[model samples]
Target: MPASLTIQLVNQSTSENVYAYITGLAIQHGMARVFLKADGTSLYFPGPPPAGKILQPLTENCAIPLGPPGNTVTATIPQMAGGRIWFSVDDKLTFLRNPGGPGGGAALVEPSVLNPSDPNADVDFAFCEFTLNNDQLFANISYVDFVPRLPIALTLQTHGGAVQHVSGMPPDGLDKPQTVLRINTQSAHGTLKGTVPAASPNQLVIGGEAFARPTTADILGCNSGPFATGGGGGASAVRNAIIPRLAAAFQRGCVAAADVSEHPSHPETFYRAGGPANHYARIVHECNLDGKGYAFAYDDVQPDGGEDQSGKVNAGDPRVLVVAVGGGGAPVRITSTFTFGNTSMIKLAEVA
Candidate 1:
C-alpha cells in the first residue's frame, strides 16, 4: 500500500457551510491522536491540557472547508486506525481535548448525540469510520449513532480498474425513516414475544445463558441490555458470539429447533412483519439506496458467503476515496491528477 491515501471530499449539499474534519490515531507516528489540519494535508496533534481540566478547545483549526456545492476538496492522510471523517452542515463541530488519566494518554472528545449539553448538540452532522494500514484501506458508513440529516456516500477506486460504490440516502429520505420507525416501535410494544417454547416472553435462552429482554432504546442503540459489554470495557467472547445470532433471530422473528441460536444466513429473512423486529434497523437499511449500511453494532456479522449488510468497501490497491455529502448526486469518479503538499496553518479568526 502507498504511504498515504488521498480522499476527495465533495460538497453536494445545498448548504454552503459544509466542513469536514478527519481524526484518528496515526499509525506511523506512534499512534498519536492526529487530526488533519485545515490545509487538508498537514496533521495536527493536540498537546495535553492542564491536569484535571476538561473540554479544552483545540489549539489549531482542523475543519477543512469543502466550499460550495459541486465543489471537491482533496485531503491526504497517513496510515491510521479508528479513523473518522466527520461532516457538518451550516455549523462547525466542537471538538475538545480531554486530559489522560494515570498511565493513560490524552484523548479526543468528538461530538456526542446522547449528551444533551454537548456543544454540537444542535448541529446537523454525520461521520464514517475507516482504517488504513499496511494491509488495506477499510471504510464504511456508520449508523451506530443517530442518523444525521446529511447523508454520506462513498466511492473507492482501486488501481486495477475496479470501482465500488455505496449510495447513501436521498435528500428527502429522512422523513420516511422517522414515520416508519414510529409505526414499528408502536407495533412491537403491542405484540406478543418470540415463539420459542424454551424461551420466556422477555428472555432468550441461548446455550444455557439467559438474556433479558432489551428495552426499545436498547434495541436501537445496541449499547445496553443484552448488547452491552461490561462498563466501558470490550465485549466478552460469549456476548460477541451470541449477539449476532440473537439479533438476527429477533429480526427474523423465529428460532431454529436444532440450534435455537441459529440465525438466518440470508438478509431477506430479516425484519418481517408479524414478528418482533428491530424496526429502526429495518427502516434504516430500507432507506439506503442499496439496502446496505450499518444499522446496528453487530450488523457486520454474516455467515459464510452471505451478503454484507455493513456497507464496507476496502482494497489493498486503493487509489482514491471519494466522500460525497448531501445524499443525491452522480457517483464520483477517481481522478489521478490530484497532488498533496504540507499543511500551512490557517488562523482561527480568518475562518471562524
Candidate 2:
C-alpha cells in the first residue's frame, strides 16, 4: 500500500513556506507519495527529490506573521503509512537556512521541527466500535454471535389468583391484556423463572370462549384438592357454583359445601369458611415451554388492612405466589395461598 501523510498548518510563516518544508520532509522520508493540505487547500510539489537527497528551501530566516494579534501558528502530525513527521511554529524567531556543503542541498537532510507559540494544533479522532480476534475463524464467529439471529423463547407462569379480565368480571368478559415478559440471564447458563398474575379472567378465555364452564372438577383444577366437586347443571348454576368453589379452594383450610336451588337464575349456594380473610382465591399458570421460564400468581381477595379493593397481588402480600421448575426438572408447580382459579392459562413460546 502506498503511504500518505496529513499535516495541519495553524499559522505557518506562509502557506508557501509551510508547503516547502513539508515537501522536504516527505522527500527525506522516501515516502511513495506526499499530500499536503493547508486550510483545506492542496499544495503541489514540482518534482521528486533526487536519488537519496532531500530538497530544502534556500532561505533559513522565514517569519510567518502571528495569527490575529496573539495567536501563533500550530501544526499537527497524523499517522502516515511510511513514517511520521510534524512541524509547528514556536517563539516565531528560529529559522531553517540551507546547510551549505558538497552534496549541499542534495544531501539527505533532517526536517526542521516547527514549534508554535499557540497550543491550538488539536488532533481530532473518529471512534468506532470494533472487535479484535486472533483466530480468523473465531473473528467471524464473534461478529455473528451478538447479532440476535435466532428468536428467543420465554415461558411465563402464574400462581395464587384466577385469571380474569378484571375484578368481579368473568374470564370471557374482555380480550386478553398484554403483559410484560423479560428474560434475565445472569450467568453463561442457568435456569430462568418469573411469575405472571392471573387476576384477569381474559387469561382463561381461549379463542374468544371460556375453556370450560365453571364446574366443581374444573374449579378444583387450580388446586390439588381431592374433595372438589364435579360440574353439572345449567349455565347459571355452573357459573355461580364453579367460581365460588374455585375461590373456596384457594381459601386453604376451608371446606366448601354447596346447595343447588332449582331456580334457573340462581342455581347454586356456595358456602366456605377457612384460610386468611385476605387470602381467598388463587390461580397458577405457566408458559413459554421453550426454555426461558416465568411464574406468577393472582389473588382474588384484598387484604383486610388496606382500603384498596383491587384483588391483584399486593406488593408485599405473603399470598402472592411463585412457581418455578423443580430441581428434579419435573413440570413446574403452581402453588396457592388458598384455592386456585379454574381459568388459568399457559402461553407457549410467546417471547422472542
Candidate 3:
C-alpha cells in the first residue's frame, strides 16, 4: 500500500483500449481508473478535483486534464521475461502513503489542487476503471471507506440498450451483461456475494469457469417497465431514468421507480446544508442497491423561471440530478427543469 500503490504493471493487449490499466485504492478511497499507454504517457479517468469530480453512475468518463503541451504525464510498464508474475490490483486494496497512515479512513494527499505551473508535484488520481483492451475492463481504485467490512453490492440498469461486447471475449452473449459481473466480482473475492447465477448460495468454488447463466427472467431489460413518478405532472414527471436492476431480477416486473415530493418547507433530510440555492427539496429513487436505507438523495431547487432558480416542475420542466448523492445517509434530491433536453439517461453503477 505505498502512497501510489506503486507496482510493476504490464498490459498484455495488442490494441490499447481506454480501460486497459491497473487501478488503485487512491488517496481519496474512490476507485480510480489508470491507463498506461504504449508511448510513456497515461490517462487517469475521473480525474482529480476541480478538473474532475468523483466517479458516479452516468458520470464516469472524466479524464485528468493535460497541460498546454499535454505530454506532461509519463508512464510505462515493466518487461519481465521469465513467467511474468503479473502485477495487477487486488481486492483488499490497502493504499498507504510514504507516511504510512491507518487503514481505510486515511488517504494519500491528492495534490495541492491541479496547478499547471507547479507541475513538478502532480498527483494522478485512481480508483474508477481501466480499459486496457476493447475486450475487457478492470476497476481502477478511487476512494475507499474504512468501516465494518459489510459486503458491498450495486445494481445498474438502463433502458432499451443492452450489453454488446465488441471483441466477443465472453464466449456466448449474455442476456443481462450486468449480472455477468458476478463472475468478475467472484474472481476478485472468493464468496459469491453479487447476482450469482443459480447453484445454491456459495456453492461455486473460486476458480474455473462461471457456474451458470441467468434464466429468462435474468435478461437485461426483459423484466423492466416504464419509470414511475409521484409529482411534477409533465415537468415533475420523469422523462426517463437510469433504473437500478439489482431487485429487477426476482422482483417480478418492478423496474425501480422515482418519487418526487416537493416541499416548500424543505425538511431536514431534503435540505442541502450549504449550497448555491436558498431553497431545497427531495427526489426519491428506490435503486434497490442496499435497500431504501442507503438510497441517495438528488438535491435540487424548485422552478421560478428566473435565470438561476427557474423551473416548471409542475408543467414542462424535468428535474435532473446534479450531485447524485448528498453526503452519506441522506435521501437523494432532484433539480427541477422545464427543458426536454435536460433529462437524459440515468447513471447507475453496479459496484462489485
Candidate 4:
C-alpha cells in the first residue's frame, strides 16, 4: 500500500457548516497521536498538556471544512492504526488535549455522547473507523455508540479494478417517522428460562458451561460486568470469546446450543420468532439499504464462509476512498478507469 491514502469527503446535506476531523496513531511516526491539519494534507501531532481533565485548545486548526452542500473536499492521510474520521453537522466538534497517555504522548479528548456535559453533546455527529498499513486498508462504519442523525457510506476503488462498497443508511431512512417493531423482554426472558442454573439466578448454564448474565445496562454498553474482557487465562479466556456469542445468542434467541457455540453462524440461524432478539439492532440493520453495519458489539461474529453483516470495505491496493456524509438527498456517484503501466484514465460524476 502507499504511504498515504487519498480521502474525498462529500457533503450531501443542506448544511453549509459540515466539518471533518481525522485522528489516529501515525504508524510511521513512532505511533504518535496524529491529526490531519486544516490544510487536509499536513499532519499535526499535539504536545502533552500539564494535567488531566482540563480541556486545552489545540495549537493547530485541524478541522477540515467541507464547504457547502454538494461540495467535495480532498484530504491526504498517512498510514495510521486505530484511525477515525469524525464528521459534525452545522457545528465544529470540540477535541481537547490532555495528559497521561501511552509512551508519554498526549491523550486526545474526543467528543462523547454519553457525557451530558460534553461540549459536543448537542451536536449531530458520526464517525467511521479505519486502519491503513503496509498490508491493507480496513475501514468500517460503526454503531457501537449511539446512532447518529447523519448517514454515512463508503466506496473503495482498488488498483486491481475491484470496487468494494458499503451502502449505509439512506438519507431519510431513520428520519422518516414510522411505526417500528418492538422486542418484548418478557418473551426473551422466557426463552432463556430453561438455561437458568438451579444454583445461580445470575448465571445461565449452556452447553454445560456457566456464563454470567450481564445487567440491562451492561448489555447495552458491552463494557462492564460479564461483558468486560479482563486480561487473564482459564475461565476468563473462555469467557472472553464465548460470552459475546452467548449474549448475542440470548438476544437473538438461537434455538440450539451448537448455534451459539459455533461463531459466524449463518444469518438464517439468528433472530427467530418466539425468541428474544435485539430489536434495535434488527431495526438498524433493516434501515440500511444493504443490510450491513454493526448493530451490536458481536454483530461481526459470523460463520467461516457466512456472509458479512457488518458494513466494511477494505483493499490491499486502495486507489481512492470516498466517504459520503449527511444523507439528506441523493448520494453522489464517482467512477474511474485506469491502466497499469503506460496509460490511465479517471472520471468523476455526481448523480442527483
Candidate 4: residue 220 Cα off by (Å): 11
Residue lDDT tens for model 2, 1-352 = 1122222223212322222123223333333233233432243223334455434432322232335422334433222232222233333222222234222332323322122242222211111111111221000112121211111111212243533221121221112222321112222322122223366542333212233323233333443232233546433333333333334323321221223211111111212232122222222111323322212121232222323222233465453244435443344443433434865454322122
Index of the highest-lDDT prediction:
4
CA lDDT scores, all candidates in order: 0.72, 0.27, 0.26, 0.74
What tens-digit string does per-residue lDDT give for candidate 4 at 268-343? 7676653446778877877886777798887776655668887877899986666767763224455767676886
Give the C-alpha lDDT of model 3. Answer: 0.26
| Alpha-carbon shift of residue 217 in model 4 (angstroms) | 10
- Using lDDT as the yardstick, the better of models 1 and 2 is 1
Residue-wise lDDT of candidate 3 within 26-121, one digit each (tens)?
A: 323333332333233443333333223222121232222222221232343222111011111111111212222233222233222234443222
Candidate 3's clash total is: 45
Candidate 1 regions exceeding 4 Å error are 101-105, 177-352
Better of 2 and 3 by TM-score: 3
Query: Candidate 4 clashing pairs?
Result: 171-327, 264-302, 264-303, 265-303, 293-311
Which digits, one per residue and each the tens of the lDDT, describe model 1 over residues 1-352?
9979999999989988999999988889888888999999999888778887888999999999999999999999999989999999999999988886222445778899888799998898999999999999999998788666689999999999899999987874342211110011112222122332343655654444456866556665666787665524565455555665555554444333222333534676676654456777788898997888887766776655678888888999975555567875324443335334663322111111
Worst lDDT run of 10 residues, candidate 2, spans 123-132
TM-scores for candidates 1 onward, in order? 0.52, 0.16, 0.18, 0.52
